[model samples]
Target chain A: MAADRVDPIHQFHINTIVPIHVGGYDLSFTNFSLFMVIAVVLSGGLLYWATAGRRVVPSRSQSVAEMTYEFSASMLKDSAGNEGMRFFPFIFTLFVFVLMANLIGMFPYFPTVTSQLIVTVALALVVFFMVMIAGFVRHGFGFFKLFVPSGIPVALLPLVVAIEIISFFTRPVSHSVRLFANMLAGHITVKVFAGFIFSLGSLGALGVAGAILPLIMVVGLTALEILIAFLQAYVFAMLACIYINDAIHPGH
Target chain B: MFVTSAYAQTAAPSAIEAHEGVAAGGGHEAFPPFNPEYFPSQLLWLAITFIAFYYFVKKVLLPRIGDTIENRRRTIAGNLEEAARMKEDADAAVAAYEQELADARARAHEIATKARDEARAKAENDRKKVEASLDGKLAESEKRIASVKASAMKDVGSIAEDTASMIVERLLGSVASKSDIAAAVKAARE
Candidate 1:
């Protein structure tokens, strides 16, 4: 019996496919890079294929492409108002990329790009910088008035401003971590349960019997993970829109 | 349920421990997404891919979709407008047809009324003409009848005179004068 041969954390290990060292940088092509490229190819290729025909009555691929476009357009319109539509291209790319990454991750042996903290942080930072730039460019120094609300009592002003400022700064942390932690935790839990099945199977007949519960759990968790995969993508995009909305309409 | 052998159970734990040691961050281990070594490459690739994706979608896919959607929308709107215009035209045509029918009906009724009035007047004139001719004929017949009655009366007078004269002559053995007989007949008639 080799019951303890299963390792759940092993799935997260990063391996360099092409080890390249430039100066002090480790710019090697990696599994993470591969999946990001795959996501890009899949998303971009599908979009290209979908709109290649440009039929008045859309094909299925065109319908999918149109729905994706409309989904981002409407999300921006609803969250950030009409003015936010100027950022449509950026938002659309962000949404489609995240969505593709999440969906791709659901497949076996495919890694999730958004699961990487650096990638998510980078995305969140893009939104954060955009918000600051847009706010400052539009409102100048008055953009700081977003921390202050209307009709507050004099005594409670300090407390409210402090809270608002802290919450405002926490946006990127929450934004990135929400996606990263959700993907990491869900995958890890699924892996741990899956590991249990293999480990218990090594205990012969009795162990196989005990493995049934973990097997069922693993199956249920996989389904849940798929749901989370879609949901986290949506949440990430939605937050990006909301944050962008703050820049468009400062002080409200 | 079949139980596993005790020896297998004991062996399983050792194997599991060896697996954990091998898995637990040895030189072979790359500590997942947090691995500082993978960050630069991932970010670099992400930037390149995302920027390309943004431009590709913005430049190519979105415009085509927009054209299709806008074209479909315009076509639907045009169709609706054309249908409405056609409906209005049809309504006008039907109204004109109905108006023409109403005018024809009114003209037909007027013609019928004029024809009826003319026929009634002709009939009245014919009746009056017939009444006048009948009156004239009746008057001529009455005049003729009066002449005939006068002639019969004169003849009757003459006959009565003759009969009286004969009767007087036979009885008296003398013939009476004609004038006297005529006078006696007339007096007796009176």
Candidate 2:
């Protein structure tokens, strides 16, 4: 007797609120937009509060905030070098936004913005474009040389080049899909298992007893979802830095 | 069945035109995630929010944090340098103290050795002076004994001559001449 409200797909649904259409597009402030604003405000507020004192000896929250900054900064530098520090703000924002979205989605009935294919695609495309424009601008035609690996057999060069080109073009798809799919699948699987609890409990005594199994499964899955949330954000930000590194120094 | 039924709405001119039907609770038969109707709004909002977030991070958050971190590092480094300088000064003071101690000990040893040598030399000089005065007194006593012995021998000789003269006079029943007695005694002594 699991109702339609438990529909795993229903959580991803967008219902328009405060409908605003300009130039024939539904740009209405939906739940997604509301959450996005919430995420921004929350993250910004956290940073502000963490940095309020800036003492010689940092407070606990101040140290945490500093660690996060250093983590993002080092990730970029390790992958992309010192020049990569220039993109630290954007990378940090991307990292914080995705992390917040994923974490907030852990709450029941909250929509994960990152779960949307369009949102992830937009983020990936931004990185992709930054890479492309910066690559071409910095290296010109030499950017294409990235596809050409050094020390390749003449006969196999074409095959390797083709594979490299395809992989390069598909970077955004893979990058965006990795995060989107992790969020979508994690959320959906948890919902599906949650629905099982109701479905099983409705079967009477034995069924109610069996519901504990799914309940445990939901707990474990939620914990895992939290891990995936942090992991996916890290992966996204790390790959973005690596891609930018490729633009800066494209080679074998 | 839901997916196939919703595909029928795709024939509606454009994505924007079709969203109205979908948004109006038009019995969603299509896969919700794959629905293209939501892309524009999501993209637009993402642009607006992401740009705003980036500016907040770049302008406000980053600089504030960076400065705090930098200031903290500088403060620590300055403290470390100061500690090192203080340690160096302490080490120098200790070394100087040890050097001064060593010099004082050596000087004390030298002064003690000189005082002992001067005392020994004074004692030796006093002993030599006493020994030399005692030697002079012993030599004078020996010379006086030799002269006294010679006088006693001369007295013994004169007494013997007197006794001889008395015996000669007794034998002759008259006093023999002193010259004759003396001549006889001298001849007998030779």
Candidate 3:
């Protein structure tokens, strides 16, 4: 018999064109680049279309668009307060792009960029840099004072600062890992269940009966994954808002 | 040797052995490393998204919310003003009704008082007429009584003179003097 198909991990490899030399480094766009572009265009177009008419009494599309805007706005306000308004556009855009990329992947033959660590990490890095810059700009030299809480004894300051810095550095890692792990685990589970359905189907009547169970599981998991995709986007955006709050008013 | 080699090639590798072999041989890079400088397109799109959302919130959504709130406030104010005006109108109507009620009561009282006074005056006039008629009747009855008494006294005097004449005739049995009889008759007649 022909060799059984390779495990799904092998399929995750990014294929690219000739690597471009840039500043003594190889930089090449891959399938992730294509998906990111697609996500951007689709998100932009959907929002534009949804809000194009600007009706006083909102149309269905406009209502949906407004709901999305209000949802993110309220979330930011809840997490970061009025100071969060300044970061609304960035947070909203990030949320929409991530949500679109995740949903698009559910379609046949579409790639999920969120499954890639690089994309998730890059997005997390942007959030990280923005928080850093905002803290520096707002608090100036006092930004470093964030690592030390007020009322702490001098003897405990060193230990407290070390812990605070470690926690701070782990923010991006956890942020990117949350998205990446969710997408990877959901997709792998789906693939494994699909494989079960095919592999069990060939055995006999009992095997066919057994295959039905996995098929049901696959369908259920698919639906659940779709919900997770939306939740992940929301979580990502809300956390970014929270981080921004810490930057705006550190040490509290 | 060829048959043995073909058989060996046809046998499948164990899962762990296959995984180890793939790990050892799959050294070829699948893709080049990502560089931030090459992702200008992504950065540009990010900028575009940022600007679009910024404009949407600032120019569109925020203004709409403000306008809706302002309109609601204006509507409430207008309704309150209208209600206040209606209340004033109702109060004026009540006041007018009360004033008209007082006027009607006063007019009715005035008319009743006049009717009562007129009835009293008419009663007084009727009483005076009855009293005058009664006094006149009393006067007439007294006059009639006096006239009747005079007539009765004359009749009695005539009778008395006749009786006295008869008595004198009886006492004188023979033919009395004609002159004496004549005198007696004349006295009776007088």
For all predicted structures, in order, the TM-scores are: 0.86, 0.86, 0.65
Q: Of 1 and 2, which scores higher on lDDT?
A: 2
User: Per-residue lDDT tens digits of candidate 3, residues B72-104?
Assistant: 567779999999999999999999999999999
Worst 10 residues of 1 chain A by lDDT: A1-10
Q: Rank the candidates by lDDT, best first.
A: 2, 1, 3
TM-score of chain B of each: 0.74, 0.66, 0.55
DockQ of each: 0.35, 0.34, 0.08
lDDT for position A204 in model 1: 100
Model 3 clash pairs are none
Give the CAPRI class of candidate 1. Answer: acceptable
Q: What tens-digit string does per-residue lDDT give for candidate 3 at A1-252?
A: 211232444334443433334555324444555666677767666767767766656688877777787788888889888986888777877788788888887764566877766677778988999999999999997888778889999999899999999999999999989997898778767877877887888788899999999999989999999999999999989889989888888866
What are the per-residue Cα lDDT tens digits for candidate 2 across A67-138?
889999999999999988888998999999898888989999889999988999999999999999999999
Which segments of model 3 are wrong by more than 4 Å?
A1-7, A10-31, A202-205, B1-190
In angstroms, give how far residue B162 of model 2 lies from its true place: 4.7
Chain A TM-score of candidate 3 vs. true chain A: 0.90
In candidate 2, list every pair of residues with a backbone clash: none
Residue-by-residue lDDT tens digits, candidate 1, B1-190: 1212322322333343444535644223334555554577778888988898888888987787778888888988999999999999999999999999999999999999999999999999999999999999999999999899999998999889889988999999899999899888989999
In model 3, the fraction of reference contacts reproduced equals 0.05
| Model 1, C-alpha of B170: deviation from truth (Å) | 4.8
